[model samples]
Target: MRADAARNVDAVLRTGARLLAEDPAAGMGAIAAEAGVDRRTVYRRFPSREALLAAVFQAKLDSAQRVLDEARLVEAPVAVALHRYVEGIVPVSRDWPVDVRRMMRADPAASVRREEQSGRLDRFVQRAADEGLLRADVPVAWARATLDHLVDTAAHGFPLIDPPQAADLVVDILLNGVGRR
Candidate 1:
């Protein structure tokens, strides 16, 4: 695709994510208007709203995979990996705020991709425990869940804190509880 076309697609997908997130029933014309693209462009690229939504979800997954690849979860030190993952993912999470579970329900392919992502995170969390970054006694599921919640909190709850600082806060909270030490 040409540079301008790619830019238009990116704008459409991003605007679609934001508008659809705010209102799932948002129309293609509205999205195009918000994205500053022609409605024909949106319709040309995505025959239907569902297709556009699927594309948006795929964009989120692609971004997530990129973050995981960059974080080097398997090779990096657990603490370092955790911080990198959080820092990279917070913005991705915020940028593509679509719910993975909902996407999974709508598209089986998305479900598989999400499961793969979850599996990798699970392994990393388990590694963290094995490496003494997390308590061995804590169930891996619980730890992963807490980590997920923390990332979500960092992404959505702390609007003022930048991603890097949010990552630091998340890592600290995950490693050491909010309870008085």
Candidate 2:
């Protein structure tokens, strides 16, 4: 694409990622304003609200994967690492990458992203079970789905006036649910 087109793409990604994460009800026009672009530009790149959200969602997922990579989740006990990773999802809420998880929920490619995370998280759970820290019958996919559900819930609909405390509630429940007895 042209230089300006690339810039527009990056801009929409940045804006969509933020407002959408902070509030799922955010609209494309707001994202365009944040990007310093017009509706025509936003539509040209994203085509529809769903399309824009997809790009935003993909960006977020890719970023989280990179964080997962850099944190070296493979370096620690799989259970400990995965729990901390999922918890990170709550406080880690900030910009586009965070929006990826949030937007993907409504975006068309959500199942694809879900499957991708599911596979990766499942591997981690399987490793945890292998290490005898998790129940042997615990399904890896279920663990992954649980984490996804928790992170998004904690991100958007935390109960307390304080978001952090609400996140804690989620993390504690997850840890307890999967904790070895």
Alpha-carbon lDDT, every model? 0.92, 0.66
For residues 21-55, could you state the per-residue lDDT of candidate 1 as single tens digits? Answer: 88999999999999999999999999999999999
On TM-score, the candidate that comes out on top is 1
lDDT digits (tens) for residues 1-181 of candidate 2: 9998898888788888777766777888888888899988898778887787777677667766765664456687654565557555554454544434355467656658656765666677667656775456766567656767876776665633244465456556655674566
Q: Give me the overall lDDT of model 2.
A: 0.66
Clashing pairs in 2: none
**lDDT (Cα, 0-100) at 90 in candidate 1:** 94
Error of 1 at 32 (Å): 0.8
Model 2 per-residue lDDT at 87 = 52
Choose the strongest candidate by lDDT.
1
